[model samples]
Target: MAESEHSSSENASMDSIEEHSKQDSELEFSDDEETLIIRMFNLVGERWSLIAGRIPGRTAEEIEKYWNTRYSTSQ
Candidate 1:
């Protein structure tokens, strides 16, 4: 019973960490970055790596997720 309780606590801690990371990943982009991302996305299309490279301090995956979540027509 003690071990089970410990395991549950660990799982809860892990879930909180995961939730924080998800929130961090959904970072706010500056106006310039937003404009650049939109323009590059339009010109190059979902080419996230290329777009991320053009923007400082952002990853391809993050940009892709942000665009998909906030701007993608399919969403």
Candidate 2:
């Protein structure tokens, strides 16, 4: 019973840490970054790594996700 309680506490702590990391990883692009991403998309077309390289402090995956969320049409 005591071991089970300790395990549950550890699990809760891990859950909190994971949630915090998810929040931290969320994309918060500035106006300039958004404009740059759009212009880069027009120039390069889904070349997320290339676009991300041009934008400071952004990852390819994050930029791709942002593009998809903002631009992709649901079917």
Model 2, 1-75: lDDT tens digits are 999999999999999999988865577788899999999999999999999999978889999988888889884
- Worst lDDT 10-window in candidate 2: 20-29
Query: Which one wins on TM-score?
Result: 2
Number of the top lDDT candidate: 2
Superposed by TM-score, candidate 2 places the C-alpha of residue 16 at a distance from the truth, in angstroms, of 5.0
RMSD of 1: 3.0
Query: Would you list the clashing residue pairs of candidate 2?
Result: none
Error of 2 at 3 (Å): 10
Total backbone collisions, model 2: 0
Write down the lDDT that model 2 would get. Answer: 0.91
- Name the regions of candidate 1 deviating beyond 4 angstroms: 1-22
Among all windows of 10 consecutive residues in model 1, the one with the lowest summed lDDT is 22-31
